[model samples]
Structures are given as C-alpha cells and as structure tokens.
Target: MLSKRSVAASVLCALLATGATACNGDKGGPAAASAPASARPSASPVPTLAVDTLTADQISEQAHAAMAALASVKVDGELTMDGSKLAVHLTSDKQGNCSGTVASPEVGQFELRHSGSKTWLRADETTWKKAVAKEPGATAQDAAIAAELFKGRFITGGDTRAELAEAAMMCNLIKGLFADDSDKGKEKIAKGSAGTTNGVKTFGLTVTTGDGENLTLHVATEGKPYLIRMEQTQGSEPAAFDFSEFDKPFTVQEPAADQVVDFSVFEKKVKKA
Candidate 1:
C-alpha cells in the first residue's frame, strides 16, 4: 500500500505534469487575494542576430535570445506525458500576452488567456473539478462554483506569467535545452544533411539534453534561416512542433464583465456557505 505522503506526492506530480496548462503559483487552497499584475513589454530594440554559418549551439543560443525579442509568436505542437499525448496551440507576445488551448488526455480540452499575471480560463466542468480538487483547502462551495458558476466560462486569476510561460513552452520549440547550469559536449550538437519539409528547404540542428531529451530543429536555409519545424524525442517516438507567425500580433479577448467570475467572488461565497 502507498503511504499518505507517497500518495500526496503522486497527486502533486500529476497536477504539475499539466504544466504549460495546469494552474501554478499559489493555487493549492482557498484562492488567495489577487493583486493586479501585468506582463509589461521589455523596452529594447529587436536584437539583430547573426544566424549565418553558425554551429548547432550557435543556432540554439541565437534562437533562445531571439525568442524574447519576438513581439508575438504562434506555436503548436504535441507534448508526450506518461505515454499520452497532450496537444497544444499557443500565440504569445514578449510582454507575457498569451492565448492558447491544451488538449490533455486526462482533463479534455482547456483554454486559457493571459495579460501579465492576470489570467482568464475556459474549461469544462470536469476540468474545473479536477483543478479545484487539487487545491489545498478547497471547500464544498468551491466545488459547487467550479461545477455551476465557473463551468464553461472564463474565470480570471492572478500570477499568470508562469502559467503563460508554461502555455507558451508547450509549443516553445526552443528553451531550457541548454539551461544555464547544464552542459553536453560538442558531439551532441551536430549538423545533419539538408532536407525539406512542406516545401521549406532546411538544415538540421540537434541538441541532446542532460536528461536525454532530444531536440531537433529544421531551420530555413534560403532566406533568414527561420525555425520552420522542431522535433523532440518523447519516450521512443519524437513529438513534432511547427513554428510560425513570428513577431506578429496576438490578442486574447477578455471575457465580458457579466460573463466573468474572479476568485474573490469564490472566496466570499465559499466563506459564507
């Protein structure tokens, strides 16, 4: 039999596994008081990167740096988790503006949008129930609201940068592969033969993570060497990601005031009930 702590650990892992979609940041219990937060844009000119005649590490490093300068980006891909597929789609701006949906095998399709630390979410009743059940001290009223009031509607919350980043990373073909503290030798970052995908001529750059996660990017060769496609090894099979809409505009419409419910309402109702 599993001990209580083991079970709790298992549950926590399961909840976190929904990263890039699952709620994070002070989300375990009765919703905390939410203060306004915004993902303001970084005030800097778009960095001009040298992408020509670069090595695999250069490609990755350049791509990570360029990603921040991107005013907006659209990313879509598959994420493999515990042998199941979590398909996701996202569009985000550098200022933390994000809008996307993740279709999880466990909880069905859930959509979330964010402006800075403020987030609005739309999901089915089951997803909401699963979300609140993970809360540290969620009450019966919380469950009721999750089922009736917040069901099938957009609900706002605080601390959304991490959540938005997770949503973006769900489709982020490049990030964390060469995290600051981890390192792999030159052998892992290699150049492969030229190829084409969907009529886009490209060369391949592959980086193997410290934990054995493999990332491969097919970059456009003719023009600016834009990242056209990405593939990552998940389990035995590789998950594919397609990148587009670089530096474009992305807007996540807020739910109408009448249609939205914030956590403060939940706190008041739960306490009174």
Candidate 2:
C-alpha cells in the first residue's frame, strides 16, 4: 500500500528506532555490534586429556608414574637373589630417613634405623656371635673384632663415606629390588586382567625378558592406580613384594645414649688392644 520512497523511509525509521546499524535490504538481519576482543567473554578451553580404560601394560606404566611421585612408601618383600633370602619390612623416605628390619637365614635379623645423616645397625645377639665367629673355630682376636664392630651394642654407620652411601642406597636398593622396572614393561606377554588380591581390586599383567625371565605386576584400581604387588620366579621359589602406605611419613629417631654404642669407641678400644 506504500510507495517505494515511503517503504524505504519506513525501514530506515524502524532501524533508527531499534538502533540497528543495518537492516534487511541486502543484509538479512540486524547486525549486532561486536565487542572488543579483550572485553568479549572467552569460551572455556576444551580438555585434551581423556579418561579411558587402561590395558595392563598401560596400567603398570601409570602405577610407576604414581610411585615416582611419592615421598615415602612401605615395603614388605622377600628377596632371593643374593642368597640372603632377605625378608624386608620397612618404610623408606627419599630424604634419608627409614625404619626397618632386614632378616636373612645366615645373618638372622638386623634392625636398621637411619635418621638425618646417621645410620644405626644392631644385629640380634645370635647373629652378632655368628658374624664375629669368622670361622667355625673363632680365635679370641676374631671375637674381639666382632665386639669392636658393635662395641657390644648399636653401631653408627655414618663414620665413612662408603658406609653412609650404603645406608643411603639401602632404601633405593630395596625399591629397585622389589618395584617393577619400567624398562621391562614393553615385553609384557599377556594383557592385564581385572582381579582382586587379599580382598583388594587390582589390574594385573605379566612380562618376560628375552632370556626367559618372567615377572607379574599387580596395580590397585579402586583408588589411585598404585603398584600393589609384584611376583617373580627365581629358581624354584617365587619371590613376592607387597607395597602400601604411599604417603605416610616414617620417622627414625636416634637411639638413647646408653642404647647407642658408637663404633668409634670400639675402633679406639681395638686400636689400644
């Protein structure tokens, strides 16, 4: 009902009323004024990482990653490689603090307590006697040497660099001996299966080396994927390692003055004798 000029005027009036920069003439709709890029609300970033089911091999790798992040861990293991048949139960921290016992068929049991820069070692009386024996028939001199080593009591292991290194390396040695080696992961022969051990859930996988060595790793699944257990066959016996206490702090306090028999006193005594 309106002339072309009248229609054009109406459209312009409508646009002006609405404050539109442009309206449908060639353009289809009112164009929204763009905000400054800095003022614009940004869309949240999409997560690139995905959570999915993991394979046994994959789980083992993740468990290792978890262990590497830990400050301390509890270890209960039976080691057979050195004929020590060493039964170890301990809590080890990377900063040179630990409390544990290393027992063997030959050496009986040695209580190990390391704190700060000092390591204290005390073998059971029977083990001490056997250690000092040196031979089936021990000379008085051998007995004296044994007494000198212990000063008839707890001995400090921090006197020498090698001794300190040995004390420091003890925790790492136990970790290496029991924990699954990541390098052996690729050779895992079978896929891991979900199973439970001792009422706990786990993801378990087995791997072997080129030389026919085989080992199995079990990773906990209910919570964080942690390496819960490991098994390896050595000769006819199967050695086992159980891991727990991921983040708990283990404290090793110094023995009482009377309880501690410093090795230096024994060294001095032996030098005088």
Give the alpha-carbon lDDT of every model: 0.54, 0.53
List per-candidate RMSD values in Å: 9.7, 32.9
List the pairs of residues colliding in candidate 1.
Answer: 20-166, 28-135, 28-136, 39-116
Per-residue lDDT of 189 in model 2: 56
Instruction: Provide the lDDT at 83 for model 2.
Output: 36
Cα lDDT over the full model 1: 0.54
**TM-score of model 2 relative to the true fold?**
0.68
Per lDDT, the best of the predicted structures is 1
The digit string of per-residue lDDT tens for model 1 on 1-273 reads 443333322322333356543223111101011111211112233333344567777766655555545666666666554455666566766665678876666656677676655667677777756655666655455556656877666755455433334544433322332123345353367676577644556677876655565667776555444565677654553466566676656677877887777644554555455
Looking at model 1, report the run of 10 residues with the lowest lDDT sum.
Answer: 27-36
Query: What is candidate 2's lDDT per residue for 1-273, written digit by digit as tens?
Result: 443333322321221221111111111111011111221111244221111455555665666776666677776766554233556666787664788876666546677777767777776556655554434333455445554456436666345534433544555523453353544634655655777653456667776655565777666665555666777754544566676676765677778877776555544444444
**Model 1 lDDT, residue 269, Cα:** 55
Q: What's the C-alpha lDDT at position 80 in model 1?
A: 55
